[model samples]
Target: MTAPIVTRDEPVAGTPMLDARLVVDRGAFRLDLALRISAGEVVALLGPNGAGKTTALRTLAGLTPLHDGYVTLDGQDLDRPDLSRWTATERRPIGVVFQDYLLFPHLTALDNVAFGPRRHGLDRQRARAVASDWLGRMGLAEHARRKPRQLSGGQAQRVALARALAVNPALLLLDEPLAALDARTRLDTRAQLQRHLAAHPGATLLVTHDPLDALVLADRLVIVEQGRVVQEGDAATITAQPRTDYVARLVGLNLHRGRADGHTVRVNADFSLTSGDRHDGEVFVAYPPSAVALYPRRPDGSPRNVWPATITGIQRHGDNLRVQLGGPIDVVADITPAAAAHLHLGAGQPLWAAVKATETRVYPAAPGGSHPE
Candidate 1:
C-alpha cells in the first residue's frame, strides 16, 4: 500500500442485511443459493456468465420470486416459499443499481437520486436535500444539474450509485456497476466506488464478472457456477485456494483435476505429479504460471512435474510474455521477454516445461462427494 491515498470514516450502524437461501426455477435454469452478508460489509457475487449471480441479486431485490427456500433481512421474512410469505420489490428495504444505470434521461442527476427518497415518502425538499448530500459524497455535486447523457461515464455511474444510496436502504444491490465504463474510467471509478462502499453502513451485494473488481471492493466472495454455490470465502482465502477450475482460471492458475494419494496426484490417465501438500481421493493440483520453467530440451533435475508440450499461443502478459501450451495438460507459462526471445518461442514450437513438486498445491475436491478421476 503506497502511503494510503484515501481515507473514509467508519460505516455507521444499520439493520443487518440478508441471511437467506434463495431458490428460483426458470425452466431449465435453476438457482439454488445460500448467502449471508453482514451489516456494513460488502460481499461480491462472482462467477461466469449465466452462473446465477444476477438471479440471486434479483431475488434479493424482490424482482424474482422464490421457487423454494426463503429470504430474510434482519430476521424479517422477505420470502418464504413454504409459508407463502412474499414481499413486493418496492416493499423490500433494498436499493439496486442496475448494470446500465437506468438513469432517467429526462431528469437531472439530483432529481434522479431524489427520485428514490421521494418515492420512499420523503417530501420534495427533504428528498432533494438527501440527494444533494449523496451527490456530494459521490463527488458529483457540481454534476447534479446535468442529465444522464450530459454526464461522463464515471459521473453517470456515480449518480446511479447516488440514486441507489439516497433511499438509505438496509441492503444495496449493485449489478456490474462499473461495467458501463471504459478501461480508463473503470480504474478511477472503481477507486471512487470503493470509498463509497466502505462508508455504506448497510449490507452490499455486488455482482461482477471482473476479478479485480470483486477482489478490491468486497470483503468476501460468493462464487456460483451453474447456479450453485461452488465456493465462498474472503478474497485472499479464495485466491489462495480455488476449489473449481472456473475459479482457478479466474485467479490465473493452471489447475487440473486428479486423484490423490500421499504426496502424488494422478492428474490424468498417463500423467501424475508430486505435490508437497498431501490429499486423498479426488483432488485438484494448481500452480501459478510463473512457477513453470521452460527448456529447449528435457533439462531434467528433480522437478517431478515435467512434460513435453507444443506452444499453442503467445501473448504479452504485463512485463512478461505468457506462452500457452497444449499437451497432457493445457497450461500457460509466464516468462520474461528476454528468456522468451532466447528460446525463440512461437506458436507450434515444441518445448519442455517443468514445475517443482513444491510449487504445486493439492487439495481435496470435496469431502464425501463422488471422487471423479
Candidate 2:
C-alpha cells in the first residue's frame, strides 16, 4: 500500500512551500510584497481595506499576473517576468477558498467537494470516495446529500475548504475565509478552520483584515499596506511593537513617530517625549491605551510627560471607553466608566494627559518605516 501522507514535520531541503517576490501594478495602486512560507506553516496577510493584501494573495496563487518579480513553489518557478515564465492558475499547485465560498448552488455537498479531484483527472468513483472521506473528517457526513443552498454559511465554508484540500495542493490560499459569516458562526468556523490547518502538512497563506483571525489562525503575520510589506513577525512581537499607526490601531495600541535625542524624542515640532531609555535617531514610541492617565486639569505633580490635551471624541471599545485626545500629539486613553464619570470627561472637554517616562518604549524604526498616507 502507498504510505500514508506524513503529517509530522519532515525536512525538505530547499523546499519552501511558498515564496514570492511579487510586484504588481494596477493604475495608481502598486503592490510590492516579499513573502515566504514553510511547510506546515500558516502565515496571515493582514492590512486595511485597499491595502493590497488580496492582491498579494492573488499574485501568489497565479490568479493575478505579476508586473515584475517571480513566484516559486516547492523550488519550482511558477512565475518569472524576466524569463517570460508564467504558470496558469490551474497548473499551479495551489488551492483557493474565496471569501464567498463559491460552491455550485445545485451541487450536493459531497459532489462539490469531489469537483476538484474530478477535474484533476480522478475517476468519478475514486473522487466520490475521497470526497466522502473528507466530509466525514469535517463531521458533515450526514449532510453530504444537502445542496449548497441548503447549507448554512459555516457549512458551506467547510465544503469549500474540503474541496480545496481534496485537491491535495502544495500551497493552500484562503482569502477572507471567515469574513462572510455572522459573529457566532465565525467563531465556530474559525476554530474548525484552525484545526484543519494545523493538520495540513502544506504551507497555508490566509488573507484577512481581522486581527483576531491573524492572531488565532496564523503562525506569523505579514502586515501589508499600499502593496508593500510594512511589518512581519510572530503575533506576540507584532502586538508589542506595531510599526505603523494602522497596525497600532488594529492591535489596539497608541503609536507615535518622532526623532530621538538622548532620552527625549520630538514628535512633530510641538510635541516631544522623554523616555527612560536614551537613544539618538528616529524611533517609534508605543504604549497601551491603559498607560495614559487623564485629568480634568493640569495636576500639580512631578510627572515628566504631562501635556495639555482636549477630548476630541469618546467611544466604547470592548469593556472600556476609548477617549481620543488631541494636543501637540494625538493619543488614545482607555478608562473605566467610573473614571469617565468622575473626571466628567466628554467630547470637547479640556484635559491633561500624562505618561511616565518608564512606561514609554522606544525602538529603532524599520527601514521604509510606516508609509506616508
Clashes of each: 0, 0
State the displacement of the C-alpha of residue 193, model 2, in Å, after optimal TM-score superposition.
0.8
Q: Per-residue lDDT for 183-292 in model 1, tens only?
A: 99999999999999998888899999999999999999988888888888888867877888888889999888889999989888988888998788988788999999
RMSD values for the candidates in order, in angstroms, are 5.9, 3.0
Q: Poorest 10 consecutive residues of model 2 by lDDT?
A: 1-10
Clashes of 1: 0
**CA lDDT, every model vs. true structure:** 0.87, 0.88
Specify the highest-lDDT model's number. Answer: 2
- Model 1 RMSD in Å is 5.9
Q: Tens digit of lDDT per residue, candidate 2, span 1-373?
A: 2122223346375657777899998879988888889988999999999999888888888888999989988777899999999888877777889999899988999999998888777778988999999999999999999999999999999999999998877789999999999999999999999999998888999999999999999999999888888888899988988899899999989999889999999989888988989988888999889989998888787778999999999999888899999988899999999899899987888899999889888987755534334
The residue pairs found clashing in candidate 2 are: none
Q: Residue 73 of model 1: what lDDT?
A: 83
